[model samples]
Target: MLTMIVADDEPFIRKSLIHVFNWQEEFGIEIIGEASDGQEAYELCMERQPDILFTDIMMPMMGGLEVAEKLKAGNCRARIIIISGAQDFSYAQSALKMNAEGYILKPVKLPELREVFHEAVTRLRQEKDHQLNFEQLRKQVQSNMPLLREKFLQNWLAGLYRDEGELWDKIGYFQLPFKRGDVLTAGVLQLDDYQSAIDKFSEEYRQLLYFSIQNMITECLEKPPGGISFVASENEFIVIFCPDQAAAPGTGAISSLCEEIIGSIKKYLRLDASIGIGRACSSASELEDSYKEALAALVHTFYTGHGSILYIKDIQPGTAALQSTFFYKFQARLMNELKAGHTQQVLELLEKLFDRLAAPKLQIDYVQSICAEIIFTSARALYELDEDIEQVLEDRLTIMDTLYRQKNISGLKTCMLSLFYNLSTHVAGKNTSKNSKTINRIRAIVQEGYARELSIARIAEEVFLTPNYISLIFKKETGETLTDYITKIRIGKAKELLHTTDLKIMEISERVGYENPHYFSTVFKKNVGVHPLKYRSGK
Candidate 1:
């Protein structure tokens, strides 16, 4: 709703104009003030700043034209409408000069008044909408400023800029709290097993998770003066800390801050993270050196393990223990144990190999090479027995991919153990007549639980074999696929139920493990040449 003011020298005219229309009901305008002279009208309009104003052209003290001119100059927001009995063309010209909304002859017609008032209200609404849109746009820009600053920080740390002047310009533009010679320490924080940790989320949700992690880290780092944090990569965040005092923050301060960040993530996100701190540097230009050092320190996690706070100053490289001769000797023994189907000896040898690899903190490249040799040699044992690696390992297609994805020693150990155990199962199953026993066990499980959700994988778990291995043995022994066997069992049961009892089709379908009666009917028709109801009726 809009407010309005009416000004006329005569009291009758003022009252008539006020009552000319039900202003609030018809136009959403309420008469706020009444003025008898041009001076009064100008003052009222200035004070109230009404949305619509109506004034007589001729008045005492000041004319309506003078009032309108002064109001325009004063930046009053009211929409001015001129009313005059004069036939002078100059009055309308002057009214337009002052940007009056409309000019009307003395006796106002309701149609003209309504049209002019409606136009003013519409114009005001458009201006108001524009103001609101501008406010929203301003707020969006403000929110994105932080993202812009983060991108700049990421580029700067990557040594993208060579000019010191350009670097300082950006630093000042981002309002970074660093000066020319501030002592800076950089740290890199990484999520443990980042691939496995966030593999369950979609790409969009992964970004949201990253945002949550960064927020937690930022809160934990708020205590360090002039510390700026930004995401350095998919699974890593970097923090550069500058102490407000002359002395730089020691390793203790950095460790405590990193510990807080790790604890917060664990407590809230139920995730583990590790941090690597670099040595302090003297200037902004040396930040890349410190950052690289931080990354170098972080790689030692393969030896130190996850959830560790490693500092560059504290890292001491260990002696190399396992040479090429040692690996060759171990690999030969492992192959013999695997080929002989000595499952226990194979596992014991695996433990021994890892034990040797564990000591002396070997380089990741050396460790990966040895692990690859172990996998291939063990896989060769399976191949000699005419068994497929796909039948022995779950992720056979991406075994090497999975190996490299291991972030630390523990995860790699787990992956290798899983691989060796599955291979051992196949080797042990091969030597013994477990294939016959596996078929019997699968038949017994299916005969008893055919009415439940039975899958080849689930049956394989019960019989200590992979789904592919069990499926292969079952097909070889029974002359049918495992799925066909299960379906045959279900159909045979349905036939017995149909012949022996007078039960509903849906009931028979459920008893035979078919959840949808229509699907059960379809399968029954396809298998037995008739539907269950027709079969029961001996059609």
Candidate 2:
């Protein structure tokens, strides 16, 4: 609420000003004080620091003009209104010079007083809004700087900056501690079996887990002086360590730092990680080469196994590549066995493939690449039979994750054997009483998901059949339309709840898959010969 003081020598005038209108109720203005003279008005304003002041132009002891001048000298912010009994132009000019809000002669009108007060209130609210908006914008800019910095760093690691001038400009803009000739090194860290580990969690939970992992890494890097960490991919994080010296640290110090980070993740998050450190470079621009070396070292996890810190210097070069003829021969025989639903033959073929992969000096990446192709082949086989691989194999999303998590040929063979076995059963099941099986699948879906949306398209998607085909089979096998069956199931559940529980009608409606309570009542009455309330009351 805005506050004001009325200052006038005449008692009648002061009382009239105070009681003329419902200022507090209508304009939200409170009369904090009534001063009988200019001295009292100045004192009251200084004491209370009211939002507004009203005073007479002529009064005893001092005048309103002197009060306004003294208040202005004191840097007061109140809106001043000057009252006078004269129509002289000089008094009006003086009021304007003093920046008084108004000059009124003896009698005051309600409309004039309301207009001035409303303008003051509107101005105050606008100023408040402006201040609030500015503060919010300032906070948003401050919070987004880290994200912007991370983007610049990611691009730098990707070798996106070609010009030295531009690279230096960004380094300065992001306030990176590295100078032109500083030595820099890179390390890549990856959460072992990341997707398989979090496959059961919701998407939001996975994001929170990743955020916590990043925070832990950031805290671990605090002692290393100039290490900066940022996410490089879904399961990978990159750290660029810039040591403040002419030469890079010894390999022992770098190894210890990486080991510390890896140990922290394992101990606190209960997750294993591997770190691959690259050789140090002499300048920031050469850091991209270091990044590539780090990634190369990381991929050796396919050979060295998880939770092992590998350095580029420790890697032994290999000259072996997969023979094209052997790879294609296995792929062809495996695809045919998979399509024919021959479980035994598929397992035999997988064993042969693993034996070949276990050969020494074989390219590790080529081993994983061959396994990835085999997984896709299984999915394609299901597709050829007009079935969704996801529905046929419940672990479709985790299949690739499992493949990538394998650290040796034996683990990869086990994951593939399981996938092909499931696919084989589904393929051979097509020879049974297909329509009856479809009916059973439809009923099971409705039974388990009754409280969810149960449209025919949704059920068809779950069973990997067309909506029309499922509807026809359901009617043929059960002697009832699918829609009527769903309704019957819902109404039956609703009736049971009405009789056995004291749940509200709306709550029962939702429990039985009805979203609208009114619609639920109508359907309930039609099915049971009474409204839900009457049915509940045993009337």
Candidate 3:
């Protein structure tokens, strides 16, 4: 309800104004206070902060004009009406200059008073609505602030802000705790096995867990002056620290904070985290370099194992000292072993190559480049052996994408080994000239019936061999079992249909020879490294 106050020197005038109308019934206003002078009315207005004030233009000690001037100076938002006599006309004009709402002369007219009251009520309602709208908009922007900050930081670290002046401007606007000359250090924290952690909780609880992790990191990092944390991605966070000028460079405080974050997350969230810290950089424009160093150090978690902190300074020397010739020799040897079908030897060489690549100082981009070289080299070798490398790898883009997404060294190793073994097996098939006729006939029948119901027994019937004998010969000739070959063919067809057609999964499953769509989905995920729907969505 709207609240009001009244002030006048005469008691009869005050009583008459109070009873001037049934205010509560006509205007829904509650007369909260009454005073005998303008001084008393100003005090009541300050104390009550009423929505409206009614006062006489001329009064003892303090007049209505003085009250209006004082309230306007104090930034009071109340609507004001001045009551005056003919001699107080000049004072009433002065009150209007102070933004008073209306002027009611002595011997007030009831209709005029009612009309002024209605207008005041309408203005008050509109003001209240505007305030409510502004409050709601403020709350929404506050809630989305973190996401917006993350986007800004992502763009900043990507070197999108090329001009130093513009970068500093944005830094100030975002309230980052760095100036032009301050040295900045970057650190990245990534949850190990983040997907597995999400899988352990219900869908509804996943975001809660992420929030808890973010809060824990914030609590640890924000305790130090000039330290701030931002979400870099869903499972990754970036912490930036600018040590005080009085402190020495590479102070231990940042390292201690990182350790605290690791311990807190493990203690509270029961999750492991890997932290990679970059060397100190002397300017805001160079923060992107520091961020890249931190990420490079973080990716070493794949080699060092999780739940540990790595610093770029400690690992930078090893990467700098690495010889290019060593990598070249390793690649040559890996190709030879793959061509010879020496699986054990190839695995050993791969492990050593990964160990070398996993040096904490090595950047993720360099690692990806080396891995890509190995993939292309292997693909070329398999192509030279008359195998359709595209068919063997399924899709080159999909394979490389999966390789790049590997979170740890082990994941990368597993993906590379899978590709290498598949290529090796295909290359081995070229050496089976002695049994070409038998293998060719079995292959033809299997290829022809891949979309229909066919099995080992049926294939053996067509080949005039026992089911067991057919399986053995197929394995010897193709380096994969008959069942494995058939499954690969069916999955390849399913992938094609998924990419090219809008057919539902069940229809695709039936078309690919699987009667149960659920089983087809399971098998598809096993081979593609993602669920059918997710793969189709390109996630």
TM, every model:
0.51, 0.42, 0.58
Candidate 3, overall lDDT?
0.80
Model 2, 1-539: lDDT tens digits are 88989999989989998998788898788899999988989988988988789889998777998899999999887778888888899999999999887777767777877787788777766766897899998798678989889889888888899788899899998888777877788988988766677888899987887898788778877775457889977787898876732133345556667778888888987888998878888767678898899888887776666787877876777657668898888877776656545678878988887776766536776777677777886677568665655676646457667676676555677777887888766655652366667788788888888887789999989988667656755765678999888888898899899999999999999999999999999998888889998998883
lDDT by residue for model 1 (231-319), tens: 97888799898762213333456667877889888988888888887888876767788888889889988878878887777767655
lDDT of each: 0.82, 0.79, 0.80
Candidate number with greatest lDDT: 1
Regions more than 4 Å wrong, model 1: 1-144, 201-208, 244-251, 316-321, 385-390, 393-397, 433-539
Provide the lDDT at 428 for model 1. Answer: 58
Lowest lDDT 10-residue stretch of candidate 2: 244-253
Top TM-score prediction, candidate number: 3
By descending TM-score, how would the candidates be arranged?
3, 1, 2
Per-residue lDDT of candidate 3, residues 205-263 (tens digit): 87787778888888886676448887877877888887732133245777677778899
Clashes per candidate (backbone, < 3 Å): 0, 0, 0
Model 1 Cα displacement at 159 (Å)?
0.9
Best-to-worst ranking by lDDT: 1, 3, 2
